[model samples]
Target: MKLLPVFIFSFLLNALAVKGQGADTLKRPIAVQLNVGTQGIGAAVNYGVYEKLALRLGVNAIPIKANDVFKISGFNSTSHVSADFYNIHLLADYTPFKQQPWFRLVGGFAYFLKANGNVRIIPSDDYKYGDLTLTEDQIGYVDLNVDWKGLAPYLGLGFLKTFPKRKFNINLDLGTYYLNKPEADIIGTGILTGNSSQTEQFQSNIKNYRWLPILQLNFNYKF
Candidate 1:
């Protein structure tokens, strides 16, 4: 039994060596890539460490804003929605088959420098306080905020090649990141003060929201 285990391990090592030998070797040691997709626009630097392996260091960010997107029944409200996300990551790419150099497995970890989403709703016209109409300034606004600003682990697959066969090439990525537990809260002013009580429920609803999907395209240039 002991000898059988040793034989299996040796066979695996030999198989790995043979796979590496058959892979298309990277002619360039370093390359720069521009990434565009759901995570936003970013850039990465890749370093070929072995024939079938490479390391990537990258950064990405997205900032979004919208107006008049949220409202409640019987209320003339204007809402502003904003989201900002920033991340820095280090990833590894490995080509498992020499015959399929265009396919690769990717794994990485990212530290979110900033990840926050906010929605603020303000009365567009006037609010009736029982018998009187309250001004917009008096009614104020309600703000709902959620934050997921921490480390995340990523796993995905890459298509095409890591580096260009010529000088430039394009690749695609499909992946997802497992984010940390998110925190959520509500803050209100004036008549909206009562909405703050909903913070606990908001937090509960988003507690399990940990997956961040990614569909990206990368343009790479060899150096």
Candidate 2:
């Protein structure tokens, strides 16, 4: 993690030493980008505010579900897992060196409208209490949920030029968002009711999961 910033800094210094043309000559300052990354698929609009600065507004969303992916030791059970994340963001891209406009310093903020994860576990085996087989509902199940929704600040570096020399270009973004602290809950039914007591412990264990890393590719069209 520490090496990333150092590497970018070194590259920036090298870029500053090169001589190149500026974007001031371009007639079209507006662009649109289609993006995909850890934040899922999204689209953004970009506008150059000055020779060295551009602003972007965009939205992204991710919804995923899986079955039988989570398991417990010494237990025969089926698990369902789901995660959803949605956000709207505004970002600024600033080129510090006139000669190397390809490298940019990016700062932004996102409002996560929905960020939640859920897991449900159910016993998959038949249990007997002295020759009496227990039914599925009698065996019970457990559900664990966590949510991190609200404003998150972003900081990172951008690679390649922000806009195209002609009509199209490709760029990359490397960054991370500092998400708000999450709220967690555990709910259990029937025999697993006692599991709800562990909600506090679960929240404590995940208290530091606020850093959400991002690696995205953007396809840009200058209009």
Candidate 3:
């Protein structure tokens, strides 16, 4: 009767208070971010899940190459090196200190779509085989390729707020990723055929190359 209406009114007031409290705890519900770092240029979307927790989905890529950078003793050659790294990741950001929301703990996983490094060395000097000079095609190149394309775990710290009180903010992330075991191969043409035999040794030497360090800057826009 009359009591029921009063009870409903009270419940509605309580619900409104709870909703207001939640809205105060979080500044923004969604954000878009741009990243630049050792991992390269990337973009991410962030969603606020709680007062001090957020989740982000991001993608990044880096492609680099250099020419004539390596030299073998007693050999005249031109060398080229190149690397392509790309990944898609999901990360959780937790801010422990309510007073210092700028500092956060980050944990996540990334799947490397492409992670490869390669080096190629080609002989530029003419080779004399006995009394005859070999053509450029006769003295080909040696190529070394390494790949670590798989799932990797990431642990890091984030500086600055996950989302700004205003519309835009900047943050820094420092962390490292533990990469999976790698597979390597060596390819050679012409007189470099014997280089393939060194694959096993190279793999052993690089077996411990499983750390990917990250120092990134993120520019965020809250929506």
Model 1 per-residue lDDT tens digits across residues 1-223: 2353354345445545755675675343789999999888999999876767777899999898999777778988889999898999887777778799999887777899988889998878767789999977679799999999998877788999998887899999899877878989999998888999999999999898888899999999998
Please give, for residues 117-145, the per-residue lDDT of candidate 2 as tens digits. Answer: 89999988887768889888877899999
What TM-score would you give candidate 1 relative to the actual structure?
0.85
Q: Provide the global lDDT of candidate 2 against the true structure.
A: 0.85
lDDT of 1: 0.84
Cα lDDT tens digits, model 3, 134-214, are: 877677789988999998877789999999788999999999877878899898988888899999988998878989999
Clashing pairs in 2: none
As a TM-score, model 2 comes out at: 0.85
* TM-score for predicted model 3 compared with the true structure: 0.84
> Local error of candidate 3 at 184, Å?
0.5
Better of 2 and 3 by TM-score: 2
Mark the regions of model 3 whose C-alpha exceeds 4 Å error after superposition.
1-28
Off by over 4 Å in 2: 1-28
**Cα TM-score per model:** 0.85, 0.85, 0.84
